[model samples]
Target chain A: MKRRRRFHIQPKHLFLILLAICVLLIASTSYNTFMTHSIQGGFSTVLLPFQKGMNRLGGLVYGKIGSIKELYGVMEENQKLQEEIGELRRENTRYQLQLKELATYKELLKITDEYPDYDMVGAHIISKNSGNWFSTFKIDKGSRDGFSVGMNILADGGLAGIITSVEAHTSTVTSIIDDGRSVAAMAASSGAPCMVTGNRLLLQEGKLDVTHIDKDDDIDLSYKIVTSNTSSEYLPGLLIGYISDIDKDTNNLTKTGKLVPAVNFSRLDTVMVITTLKRTEG
Target chain B: MRKPVFYACVIAAAFLLQNNLFAAIPLIQTTPNILLVVTFVTAFIAGPKDGMLVGFFSGLLLDAFFGGSVGFYAMIYMAIGYVNGFCGNYFYRDFVTAPVLLSVLSDLAFGILVYFFGFLLRGRLAFMDYFISIIIPEVVYTALITCVVYKPLLKLEERALESSKRSAKRFV
Candidate 1:
């Protein structure tokens, strides 16, 4: 008699089945949609305190190390700063004398008299995304701190990123150098427009790709790139990077170049969120 | 220590160290994945069930804190734990080779899976650059850490199991 053996599921088999189910579930959903309001949100909410405490501890340790290192550079930096301040004082007096001339020049140029007032909020980076690339990081400040998705983030005197998501106590910043991030940029000197986009290849070399420049535009080394006046989301005149290695595209109608990003993403620890969103100008 | 609570504390502590302390270290960057080491060691020492549980929770914690996708890392880590757990029976308290080899294999799998699903699917095709620049460094770093942390983790596993067994005996 061929009696059917009793069916039994071993723990390993059960684990494999569960793993398959999870993989299939993730595969079926659109990645972007599945990320929002999913179990991750709850986990973030729960782990906030621990992350915050750990970050504070790490910050304290890093601060001490930084202070020791800065001791060696302090005298040199002080001398340099004093010299610069003296030069700036002379320049300020000279600029004061030329204020009337500058006003007339502004009028002739038809430039706006008032600049946008940028409200700022400071935040500490609590953790980075689970990858080798420093593309995304979570800050301790969140919606409660008046931070929200799409607010521009700045670090190290450069436009860093835009807030991608916000929870109550933390938010995520997707940096300008991240794989999918793109910024509308222009040469600060000539106001010639271009697009700066993140490229992994360029990121390895600590640079970004600047594309769509008209072939005739005389972009050159050391030219500053800033957010374009045409960018709807980012505020105009925020420094993005410096242009380098301008080369014509294969089509020859346009040019592309590499930009050394102003923000050193690897050293990011703190950032300022420009609270005010940019209004699209006509 | 109670097994479940021990696992929870260790995983939480590992998460904190990975996100905060190790991440803040300049030379380390994100190369040494401390949590991955914990997952690999736990799976290697305790077998499949423990491995899956550790992987799921740690991966979920990682995803929850900094992940874009909720289940992406959780799924990857869980698979890694399960696969590594197969070698659990062959583990010896004094032997480090199995754990080290398993760590390399697991870390390599993680690097490939992440590259395949995250970058390749998204049209990033610079395989040689990525393999050399990111994948190799991370795998080597993770494996090196495994060598350092393996003995301690095995000891921890032994104590936790012994305590659990004692509790079970008392219940009887």
Candidate 2:
């Protein structure tokens, strides 16, 4: 008779197997292979309904609590806003006159408008990433809603982020405040180019790093910064933020500064996604 | 089989709370890592095998939801679970200090691992700033939440184990 052998499984073997599996998953996901996409898509589709229900329930509960808290401060806030509105109305009249003059100038120069009207869809934020390391969040709109990767998201009347991933019913957005993200921006007045980079540490102060500005650039504090025309992904002329401070770099060739982002990232609820992709020349 | 199902449900619930309810609460500056707490509690009660399994699945859930790469969290959490399981010999159902302490350390480990992979690997060498700002606050928050979370999870694990043992005895 042939000798019978039995297979034995140990904890060491299990650990090695798990390690291998994790490595494989990391590799596959990094490459963004079809298998990884399908798996993520499948899981997202299954979880979408439950997540939506949870989101609504959480919103209702939080809304009740927030309203109660707001009751205490509403009167004061209303008075302050009334004064602000009066000031803004005066400012608006002056801006209207300036705009008319600018329009006349544009007509004389025969210059085309830089800002294009974009087709957009509004989306509600469903949930945010659990950890503080990344400022990515999921929104209710997805591929079904005509959202695709790299579509610019606008919130609070400025550029918020770009769509990074999309499933059937939900999509993920990496906000401008996230680490490692950079936007090509320019001073609205002088058109001097700079790079606005995200830093989580600076996020506590509601600022991002504005760097790579030429030493001779005339950009100064409180200057309005908008997206540059040369940006590969973002449509040009969307508002980014204002320059808060500028400093001479040690290298003397470039200057660095800080910017206050236009969007209030802490309370992003609803955002508009520009559905048009930036046209690229081949 | 029943035990696995129970743990899976618990992990799923923690995942939802971490991403949704806790995240929405404006009172807290940073949301606690409840899934990490669950992993630590599981590893503290159960042996390395169960700990590793729970950690792997929970980490995978996080990866599926938000991770750019699928297995970064999975590997870190699995190692945490396996290491914490070695402390099971000192575990008692009523005691809370060990679990609380271990959770803090594990959270720190998680933060450091994230910093290493997410920042350092990308040539962002600002470790001191990250440690001071992001890592410390998260560790403190997760530890405080652990005090509230540990007892309930221990009770669930005990009940599941007792039922499993009873079923096994019946088979014999």
Candidate 3:
């Protein structure tokens, strides 16, 4: 009975055993927190020998590989011959395209000789942040060369946008169709100029609007709208887009119409940014 | 203990293989979820709570690979495990057809619940699209995988559980 009673601890001794456990936990945690760097160093020392052996083995294998590659001249010659054949075929196609393009440019130069007042820069649309598409895009031109902000970036056919941001190796162009941008445009047929808001909402639907022109104005389908010299910015007669829709308002003072953008947003590969800002003498 | 360690190693290895190796076997991705089937086998064999615990962690591991929000998978998987356990109380005799259908249902339930929760978070329900595109296809694939993975895993779990019970009886 006494042995049984001794084994079965009283409530007081139970409390003492629990107290000892608490002390052990506290000491271990404090020691670990303070001595972490030293404990890590001990593990690093255990791993050192294997790491050294791996490094030595890697160097030995790489040296052997260089010598073996040097002995394989015949295989290298065959690969070079295959690469040359592929390049020649590409060159032939490019030459034919250049000849065809030169003839067309000769005709365009004859027709547009009156517009010597305009300076043109051609560029490519390289990459889009289409995940955030409406805001910005990157082009492969920069300030260290001739590119600068406010330079009008043009495609072969029409005005894309002015350069908004420039870096040493890249530039970002905010398109004329974006919400925050507007252009001073005029109907080519009517010779009437008005403020045209950017067609961002329409662009999302694959359309653009030339706003602020009157319903009585002669803005019709397929006629060009160009950036004008009259209102603050952009040169005169730079093509913006073609008039696609004429919304006739019998009641309102001014008319708004949809313009079909000449620049295809898709299939954009290359463009040039005209590095010109007209300096005011004031 | 060794088996659990081995299973952990297999989990690590499957992940590495999925990300790294070029597939010699092209059929796996289109047909089934190997890991999900393994979790299901473990659940039914372990019976409710332990199965829930294992399923919850395995689902979490899968979700971690996908970079998903943490607790979403945990809640769904725990529910799957708990339900699997409750169903374990039913007739275990007709396993051939039963296991396949039950696995399909469970996978469908898990996918639907996750989709429903996603809709609630987004504040609009896309019920038709979610059921048609995500849940049904996932269930079909999960069912195909469970058919192959369950038999072997069930046998292993049976042996382990029997041994554990014997050990418990000895202590008693």
Judged by DockQ cut-offs, the docking class of candidate 2 is medium
**Model 3 has how many clashing residue pairs?**
7
| Candidates arranged by DockQ, highest first | 2, 1, 3
Q: Give the C-alpha lDDT of model 3.
A: 0.57
Clashing pairs in 1: none
Best by DockQ: 2
Computed on alpha carbons, the lDDT of every model, listed in order, comes to 0.80, 0.86, 0.57
Error of 1 at A164 (Å): 0.8
lDDT per residue for candidate 2 within B1-172, as digits (tens), equals 4788999899888888888877766566688898899887888888787888899999988887788888888898898888888888876658788887898899999999999999899888989999998899889989888888888888889889898877766665
Model 2 misplaced stretches (Cα beyond 4 Å): A1-8, A67-116
- Writing each residue's lDDT as its tens digit, candidate 3 over A1-282 gives 123223554433433443343344335534553232233223223423433343344345545665687669757878887889888898989989998999999998768633455555555443342211133455655565677767776675677777765555455677777643689889887877656665333554556767778767777778788887674556567777888777766677777777877777643446656566644346
In candidate 1, position A114 carries an lDDT of 27
Number of clashes in every candidate structure?
0, 0, 7
- With a 3 Å backbone cut-off (N, CA, C), the pairs that clash in candidate 2 are none
DockQ, 0 to 1 scale, candidate 3: 0.06
What does candidate 2 score on TM? 0.87
Q: Rank the candidates by lDDT, best first.
A: 2, 1, 3
Per-residue lDDT for A40-132 in model 1, tens only?
A: 556677888887787778778888888888998997799888879977987897888799898889786544322347788888888876477
Q: DockQ, in order, for the candidates? A: 0.41, 0.50, 0.06
After superposing candidate 1, which stretches have Cα over 4 Å from the reference? A1-9, A24-35, A60-116, A279-282
